[model samples]
Target: MDEKEVPSLAEIHIAASHLRSMSLPITPILTSSILNTLTGRNIYLKCENFQRTGSFKSRGALNAVLNAMKIDPNLKGFVTHSSGNHGQALSYAASIVKRPCVVVVPRGTPKNKTDAIEHYGAELVICEPTPASRTSTCLQISQERDFLIIPPFDHPDVIAGQGTIAVELLEQVPDLDAILVPVSGGGLISGIALYAKRINPNIRIFACTPEGKMLEECLNKQERLWPEPPQFLNTKCEACRLQQCGSLTFPIMCSLVEKQVFTVSDKTMIDATRFAFERLKLVVELAAGLSLGAIISQSDRLDSNIRNIALILCGGNIDLNEKLPWQQ
Candidate 1:
């Protein structure tokens, strides 16, 4: 696939078929009475938390790996860098195909997440807690080992795989007025927006991110910002901690996503996370909480016409031993 190519609806459908044939369960869309009451709207939660490897990352990783193996029957292995969820997903995907995999993670990633990656049968490599360090380490390993580098969120196949979520979601909730998605490197939202917009031209796509300027500033300035400052890296929402959007994903987001990406505070995200566990009986991580937090803290900013909304609960990988954010 060309670097500039975006995934088409056909590609997304193909990905859905591939996943189904692999016996991956279709995650459910649930509704919370409390959330609906609070938001004064019909709120549907696309619960990817229950997905294989505990996140939607599984969809992209498996699709990318399958496509790579098809292209190169003699593929040696796979390599990539991730904070946590993607690493675990890729590891699980690689194992399914009986291929070796290596995951490079930052130094301070939670022990539970790192353990999960290894549990999925990937060799785990530690690197400095920076985007540059992670990328360099992954490239070095890929070069030395001749492993196919399956990036977390940049490639067309991965984006198409992620777009499968939109296909399932629209089928489940055909009349959805808007969707709130957590944005990290833009893969998830980019994929969703592409398919959702094509299916329902009037459907709105809102991006939810931790309180940071990386994405917001980039969108406002209409350009990519390199080397995000160190402070932005110190976020509680580790899933959304990427310094910038993916090169392929940013343009798609710019064209298809809502102009104003909703920013939620860390505290609001924590409250949302707690609410998910205590009230909704869902164990969502901080990144998933960002979308919920947007509804809780920024509902007033939403269009009055957006009565039926969907929130993508991106992941559920958290350290159970760690204290709740409220406790901290």
Candidate 2:
């Protein structure tokens, strides 16, 4: 679909209504005392980590599959590439509808996420850890089979499905002044911004990204960080390390996100991971900490006038048993 055809808040509500008919509803938000203490504001956390399949990806995945099946009842399967969470989510969603799913994953995906993918019965196809390799393999598979592509991000249905978060959060917290969301392919933030703006045009949106890519600069230049993803895009956090934002999502972000973009280092994420665990009592993955890290580290950078904010705790699929470099 053309970027001009980006889904709106109305499409998101339609998606949410359909999802509920399938008995999939909403995820809840919770208070973050530690974050409030650190940021000195009433920061509410929209915990997608607690979402079914352990991430917000499930919403998009499910919506994509159901919509695909509605269009083509004879659809054999769905395909996509992911470092982890999206793969598992697609697999789980496909399982519920009793359709086959094939996920193209890079060689170094976290075991926790990979295990969840297989556990949901998706066929796992391993490729070299790069966008080219993953897409090539996925395309090759799609051509060989009749499987449709339910991309990790960038699709209208997927974006609309993700927007459901804003639908819930807006209702859950009536007076939220801002929302900080982690950005990779930019689907989550795009969806949320679409809904948030339509519901309350005054709500400020911000993007939080991993440091090295300089995503804000790339977005400004209309360029991507890594055409072929770098190796460091490995374990410390896989979710937000992608080279570029989605074509559909980037435009929405440039228009809607009012707050200055914030970036965080791996160390910041790891320390925040530890903080979330020790203080907040939430075992968040490193990437999940980017939202919290943005609020904690960039307190001065944010507009001082804004009072209440919400942070999207994107996911919690980290390998708890795997020895982190910090442990070593």
Candidate 3:
């Protein structure tokens, strides 16, 4: 998509309004006394885990689905590839409109998430655990079945849909000094940064990632570079296992988001997840825990002027039956 086509603040507002009309919950901005005390700053959590489909992916999926239906009412169905959350969200969104949906999920995806995708009425197709495999399978299915592809990220409408979170976040906490977002394919942060910076130029936007150099390297080189294969698939942060950033999302991040990306280890994310559950009484996936981990372990790196920070807990889809990260 054209750089000029990046979703504007007005577009994000429209997405927020559309989501409200769809009866999507405006997830609350929660604050924890314990977290604030630990961080020495007012910390707010934008709990997208409470969102429909148990993640913010629902906002983008539904927006894209509704927009596609509006433009082509006769569309056969929808198709997309996801590690888990986006597939469930897309399936849920498609079911609301009584449309057939197909989800191309990567192999080794948690069974709980795949079960939820099927429960939401999407036909699940498993592929190799690689970005290339996911994209190829999705494309093949889309072509063969004449399905509309609502990508998990990298699309303008989807990015705009994710941007709706920023609209809600800024409205709820207008004076936030910084916003910490977990980055995967970059859709969520791209949307948030695009709108948040326009609203408050001084508000810092931080991208928290698994302890990998893809995002950091990309930012440093000022270009997208897919280094050697990432070990994301082997990590506990399955929701953010994308090997590289999205084409559309990277440029947006390069321009609007903080230059320095925060990288967190799997252990740190697991510890953060445990902390959230034990103290904050919140269930967060490892990916969501990345932001919390950064705030907990890397607060000193933040600018001195930053005080109030908002962390986007992007999802809460973990298999409790499985050995929890801390247990292992």
Candidate 4:
């Protein structure tokens, strides 16, 4: 779809209504004293981590699959490239709809993640985790078996589905002034920013990225950093280490996002994960901590009057018991 054809507020609402009509729960919960102490604001956590399939990706994946079925009743299946969360989401969604799913993942993808995808009955196709390799493999597979492409973050339907989070958050916390979200291909933040800002122009959207990925630096400098062989992209975060933002998402974020913050280290992420585990009693992955650490680190920039700040707790699809680099 052309960038001009991106979903507007009206279209987003239609997509959100589709999700609500299907009886999918969009869980938005108020933060506890731990979050308040950490962020120095009355933080509200939109626990997409507790969403269907245990991540926010289910919203977009389910919406895309259902919409595809509408377009083609015989829509054979769906395909995408994801290390973990999105793959599991698509696989689980397809299982519910009784549609086939084939996920193309990198060879380096963790076994636990691939197993989760397979557990939901999606066929796994492992390949190199580069734009060229992923696209080539997906196209080759699609040609052999008619599978619709459910890109992780590049499509309009996916963004519109993700925008539903903002819609729900607005209703749950009507007076929210800021929203913090972890950025990978920029899909979630783009959707949330568009819908939330359209409703309240005063709402500030912040993008949180892993420091190792350097996405925040790229966005802040307005230049692509890992713009070389594409294989240089940091895949450590597993889910989000793409070299560039989604073509559909970046442009929307250029105007919508208030700031982009890069995390310091994996150690910080581990610490935040443990903190969430002990304090919030939530199982957040390292990627999710990228957002929390951003807020904790940048407390000075936050506006004092910003009482209700929403954090999109995007996912909890990682093996927390595994030894992190920090543990060593």
lDDT computed for candidate 4: 0.79
Query: What TM-score does structure 2 among the candidates reach?
Result: 0.92
Least accurate 10 contiguous residues by lDDT in model 2: 226-235
Please give, for residues 1-328, the per-residue lDDT of candidate 4 as tens digits: 2446577888788878888877789686857886788777887878887888778898888878878888899888888877778889899888978989999998887788888899999999989856788889988888889888898888888888898899899999878888988888888888898899889999988887766666666666665665655533343565566556876887777767864564546566667766767778888777777776666667667778877888777888767557743465
CA lDDT of 293 in candidate 2? Answer: 80
Q: Which is better, 1 or 4, measured by TM-score?
A: 1
Model 4 collision count? 0
What's the ranking of the predictions by TM-score, best on top? Answer: 3, 1, 2, 4
Badly placed stretches (over 4 Å) of model 2 are 1-4, 108-110, 218-235, 324-326
Summarize candidate 3's per-residue lDDT along 1-328 as a digit string, tens digits: 3557798777788888988999999999999998888888899999999999889999999989988888899999999987588899999999988899999987887788789999989999999977689889999999999999998888888999999999989889968999999998899999998889888899889999886547878887778677655335456687887668887988888888888889999998999999989998998888888999999999889887899999999998878888877998
The runs of at least 3 residues in candidate 4 whose Cα sits more than 4 Å from the true structure, single-residue gaps closed, are: 1-3, 128-131, 212-226, 231-236, 260-262, 324-328
Task: Name the candidate, 3 or 4, with the larger TM-score value.
Answer: 3
Question: Candidate 1: misplaced stretches above 4 Å?
Answer: 1-4, 225-231
Better of 2 and 4 by TM-score: 2
TM-score of each: 0.95, 0.92, 0.95, 0.91
Q: Tell me the RMSD of model 3 versus the true structure.
A: 1.8
Residue pairs clashing, model 3: none
Candidate 1 residue lDDT tens string, 203-225: 99998887654677777666887
